[model samples]
Structures are given as C-alpha cells and as structure tokens.
Target: MFRALGAVLAAGLILAAAQVPATADTRAPARFSEFSVTPTSLDVDHPTATYTGRLVFTGADGTDQGVPGARVCLDKDGRCVATTETDADGRFSSPVTLSSTGAQPQLRDGEAEAFFNGDAERQSTFVGSGIALHVTQVQARITMGFDHTPSVVGDPVEVSGLLERQTPDGGWIGVVGQTVRVFVDGTRIAEGTTAADGTYRISTRVPVSDEGFWGVETPLPGRGYPYTVAFANTWQRAAHRTLVTGFNAAPEPVRKGAKLTATGRVMRVTADGSTEPATDYPVLQFSADGKKWTDLYEDHPNSQGYFSLSTPAERDGYWRVRTEDWPDLPSTSSVDYVDVGYRTAISGFNASPEPIAKGRRLTVAGTLKRDTTAWKAFSGQSVKIYFAAKGATSWTYEGTAKTSSTGHFSHTFTAAKDGTWRAIYAGSTTYVTVTGPGDYVDVR
Candidate 1:
C-alpha cells in the first residue's frame, strides 16, 4: 500500500513538470532603417498623409536582416491613428488620417511618431523627435457685394457674400457656419455667421470716418491651425457723407415767362454728428412728371453751403437740388413742386350810361386774356364787380360773375347814387388775376 501511494505521487509530480511551458528566446534590439512621413502638412484639402518605413535587426551572423510580419503604427499624442503590417521586405506603408473633432484636426506640438511594438525576437522602437508635422488650415476665399456702394452716413448698408475653401482635388467648396466680419477703414463694424450654403449677410450703418474704405475677412474655423490671410475686394472711391437739405422752389404759383428760383444747402455730416459746408457743386433739376429729371443749372455753394438757381417758369413741374456726380460724394435733396400759370390781363373794360336817371341799371363788362406765346381768351373764370360811392374811401362788394367761353364778363347793378364801378377777375392755377379800370356813372 505504501509503494502504491508513492507511485501515484510520483506520477502527479511528473504530470505537473510536463505541463510547465518552455522559456522564451531573448529579444533582439530592432530599429527603422528608413522611416518617413510623406507630405508633413495636413489640411482640409489634404486630410490624409502617408507613413512608410522598414524594420531591421542584427542577425545571429552579425549582419542586418529584415524583421518580416511585424506590426507598425503611426501615433499622435501617444495614441495610434493608423496601423499596418510589414511585407516580406520588412517595409510598411500606412495611411494616417488626422484625428478630428468636427472639421478641425486634433494636433499637439505639431509633431507625429511612427512606432512598432516588440515581438519574441525584435524589441520595440519608434521615430524620435525632430520629425516636422503641421496642421494647416484650408485655403479660403470670399466674394462680396454692397446694397449701396456709395452709402451715406446715418444710413444702413447691407453686405452679402459667399465663403469658399479649396479641396484636395483643387476644387472649391462652400464653407458652412463660419463667422464673417465687416470692416470700414480698418475698424470692425459688423459680423455675421455663414449659412448652410456658405452665404452670409450683414447690415450696419455707415460709420463716420474722414476716409472710408470697406473690407471683409473670415478667420480659420478650427483651433491649433495655421492661417493664410486674405481679404475681399473694396470700393474704389473714398467714402463721403454729404446731402442737400432745406430745399425750396418759389414762387409757389409762379407765372409763365417769369423767373423761378430754387434754393438749397449742401452740408457734410462729420463723425461727431456735426455738419459743415461742402465745397462740392450742386445741380438744379426739373421734372415734368417727377419721374425723369433734366438738369437746369449747376453752381457751387457759398461758404454757408447755400445755393440759389433760377430758370424761366414754363409748365408745372417738380424741382430738386442734387450734388454733382462726384467720385467721392453724390447726394440728392427732397423734391419741391411748383405751380406755373399763364399771365392774365383784363381788356376793353367799360361801364355804360355815364349819366343816368335814379335807380337806372348800370352794366360793367371786361374781356379776360391769358398770355402764352400770344394772348388768347381764357374761359370759365370767376370775375367780381365792385362799386364805390363818389367820395367813398372803400369799395362795396356788389356781385360776382363768371367769364364766358369768349373771355367776356359782365354784371348789372341798380345805381341809386353817384358811384364808380369796376370788374375784377380773380387769379387761378392756370391764369393770373386782374382788375379793370374804374368807370364813373351819375344818377339823374
């Protein structure tokens, strides 16, 4: 029984010894014979770079030999971003896509490392520092348009444009949801965000400046990326804030063939909200229908910024003053309307029956004529007849009469005492008012 227990114990010990694993061979130091990363710069246009290297070790015969079937990886920030295996020549090629958050690549220290883990016979090694890596921002461009190219101070200006970025294939694509800023004479005035289609719009008032120049810019979208500066095109002329103010045209009911005057002031608004006289010349224009205008006169404003222009009153029309079409300053004033009427006169005025009995009927008559190129009868006009007692200081309102188509007007009044009579035609928008010569009548 003792021999049987001892045999079983020996068998257990032999089985346990047999189950033990064999010791591994010592690892040999290995290195990358030729390791390089192609196109060290990465950008939105070219987001992928190539990593290539060869793994080698000293063989038992003291000669360098390839370590085949070994795994290689490209690491960034200690994390593998790409991996591949060595071929029969111990050469490996791997594509490294930058780790990105949104459209921005994650980069630190602007460097990368290519590494290999150890195997039973080869020790681990990596490409050391001094390998240059850069995260470059994509190339960008902008196109812009102004709602009012020559804008006035205190008025809003709208700017719109598109933002585009270059692609790897040398093509352009719109950049979405990016902030765009507007600058007037190097000062940022307004900002807006790009839409889904890369279009952006901003509205801001024209800032006061002695010399105005407008421009636009868009910074690179992501952090830790290098930028290439670019700006949109700007307007050609220096900005100006000039306007015509307090415009007037008179007389309100001017007669034909008479002088009509237009007056206004041309002022320049400054950055501090103060105004000064502008030396620019102003033009007086006339419009028959208020839609199309014709230049009537041009003259420079005085030191006080006031200008007066005169032209013969012709037909009814609108009048306005505007600054000359200067390269820097262009402005217009509010319009004024004028009513022009023909010159009118009373002719052949008389009161019949110079000597008459008491209570006799007295008749007063006259012809109303309007002058254009020539005199013509003006019809459908209201005329009044007045009477004054012979030594009376004031005339009495006797009666009213309308001129006929022949321009003739007459009225009858019963004369009870010695008096002087006259006919008067009141003026209208188309004809001038006139009073006829007085005729005296005596009651018998």
Candidate 2:
C-alpha cells in the first residue's frame, strides 16, 4: 500500500511538471504559440536609439516556452537595418538605429515588423512566437528647475519640471516631480527623488571642491539620457566651466576715483555639477553712498562665463555694485565695493525716539551723506521718521521734518500706551533703525 501511494504521488508530480509553461528558450517544444510584448509600445529617442523591449510567450498549459537565441529584425521592404536576439529573460532588445538626416522611421510609415523563427529541427516554421510592437518618438521639452537647492552629497534637493511625457500606450504622464539622476558633464553627480506633486527635492549632498562652475544634468530613468538644466559659479575652481554668470560676491573698497570692475561666473548648483551657460543675467551697479544704488551697465551671460562692468571711481566717498540671485543657479560675486580718494567720509550715523513723548510717542533720527565739500548742504536736507513697536516686521511712517538747516532733525512720538518702542530716521529714502527705552510709560 505504501508503494502504491508513492507511485501515485510521483505520477502526479510528473503531470504538474508537464503542465508547467515553457519559458522562452532555444529548445522549446513544438505547438508553442502566442507571443505578447509587454508595454506593447516603445518611445525611442531617434533612429539610432537602443531600447529594451519585453516579449512574453504563452503556450498550451503554460508549457509553451520562450525561444531563446531567436533573432528579431526591422526592415524596409527587404533590407534589414537592425537585428536583436532574445535574452535568457525572454527580452528582445536592439538599437533602433536610423538616419535622422535622411528617411526618418515612423509608425506604419514602412513595413516594420518583428519576426521569430523556430529551430531547424522543429516541424513548425515559426519559432516560439512573434508579436508586433508599435514605436513612437518620445516628446521632450525644455524644463527649468527651481532651487530648494541642495549642495551636500546627501542633501535633499527640491526639483520641479514644467514638461509632460506621453506614454506609449496613449497615456499622458506628468514629469513634474519625476526623480532623475544628477550628472556632471556625462559623469553621474547623484540620484534624486521627485516630490509627490511631480516636483523633486533631493536631500543628498555632493562633494564640492573649489570648482568655478559645476554642470547640472538630469536623466529620466529608463527613458533617456541626461539633459542640462543650469550652471554654478565658484571662485576657487581653476578652469572656466559652463554656468550662468550673474552677480558674484563683490569685494569691499574697489577703488577711488578710477574705473572699478567686478566679474565672476554664475550657474546652477546641484548634487551634479554646473550646466551650460545658455541664459545670462549680467549686472553692474554702483552706489556712491553704499545706500543708494545706480546701474551703470547690464547684460545677460552668454555661452561663456564672461562678464565686464566699468564704473567711475569714487572721489571722496564709497561705491559698490550688486546683482540678483538666479534660481537653481548660484551667483559668483553678487556685490563689490570700492573707496577712492583720501576720504574722511562719514560711514554711518544714527539717533532715536520719535514723537518726543514718554507714553504717547517714540523718536529717532539719522543721516547718510557723503564726505564732500558740500557736506554742510546735506545737513540742511529734510528727514523723515519711521517707528514701530517690538516684534513688528515693518516700520510705520510717522512724519517728515527738515533739519535746522544743519542736516540734523529730531521728533518725539506720542505713544498710545507704550511697552517697547523703536524708531527709524529716513535719509533720502534710506532709513536707520533705533530702539527706545524699554521702561513702561505711565499712561495716567
């Protein structure tokens, strides 16, 4: 009885094994029929593109195995331009190389069909099986990136996209928060993950040296190669690189009474490197008092990180230049200053407590004037007052008063019921901050 039971069990095992499906293999049994390609569609960059396509074979009782070592090809009429072989995993992949300059390949444009042939020993003509795959050109667009900028190798970076991708199966896929690999001039910079809303914020930081500018490249995974986004500028980097040369950090005390210049590279900084200089926002501004600014020259960055600005030297005062920061792109030197001449200039001066009252007002005063032969004239200029209580973001405009023809103005603010008081003395639109006594003023 035990022997009979063992025999029955062994027979049952054999039956199950026989019923098992035959994966794509060179020695698959006959009667193997039916082949389906997953994704059923493909998005290739161009004619000379290489992409992996999955082909699945289904046989009777799943016993039908895949035909490994089978050749697949694409042809126009009779000439075969590309050929691919099935892998052990039943995947057939080939570089769909074509001439972009000449005749372009299109869907249903030419007789492009996949074929599979069984081994010579097999009585059937067809190999495991062949399925038709539709090909389409991938839709790509230029997308700008924003900085939640991450520089550290493991820091999270915030990246968002403005372009959308269409899947092969007629489905619209948004690429806003798509995670992509960060690369620098063909080298892998780092990997980043996209946010839930199609924006990506990579926290991973990259190792940065004193490179002038690093390139930023992002590759859509399993889709295509990397595309550049922006460039970053650095002073320590030896060689010139791709980057948007906006405003770099300007140094103090440029030169007095001569032409002052400040220039540097600007680019996007990511775990990756800098991007090519495509867009430039060049700026060259000057300030005589270092409080009021004037733009002498301005231009955009070109493909190269070359920027030049020329301004007159200060005679007896200080002057400086400034620029705005770019998104994703780090500025080289945004500002710089210089002082020309044997200057005995008043750098800064401040006074406080407006409205001249203990409980009802707070007052403050200040002046910003160049040390010149006409310094006495500034003393006669009108001055405004601004006030605010503690924890206030903006100062309240109180009133304007003229100096006693001596560039000096004062006012006492009537406080309602003061706890803490602060004042600002406006100097030609510029204001100085000053705080009053914190002692509580008696309202009674």
Report model 1's TM-score to 2 decimal places.
0.41
Clashing residue pairs, backbone N/CA/C < 3 A, model 1: none
Residue 311, model 2: lDDT of 60
User: What's the true lDDT of residue 144 in model 1?
Assistant: 85
lDDT of each: 0.78, 0.44
Candidate 2, residues 71-150: lDDT per residue as tens digits? 65544334466677777755665656543111122322233345445455332233333344444545544243536433
Error of 1 at 301 (Å): 3.3
Question: Candidate 2: which stretches are off by over 4 Å?
Answer: 1-243, 248-370, 373-377, 419-444
CA shift at 411, candidate 2, in angstroms? 1.9
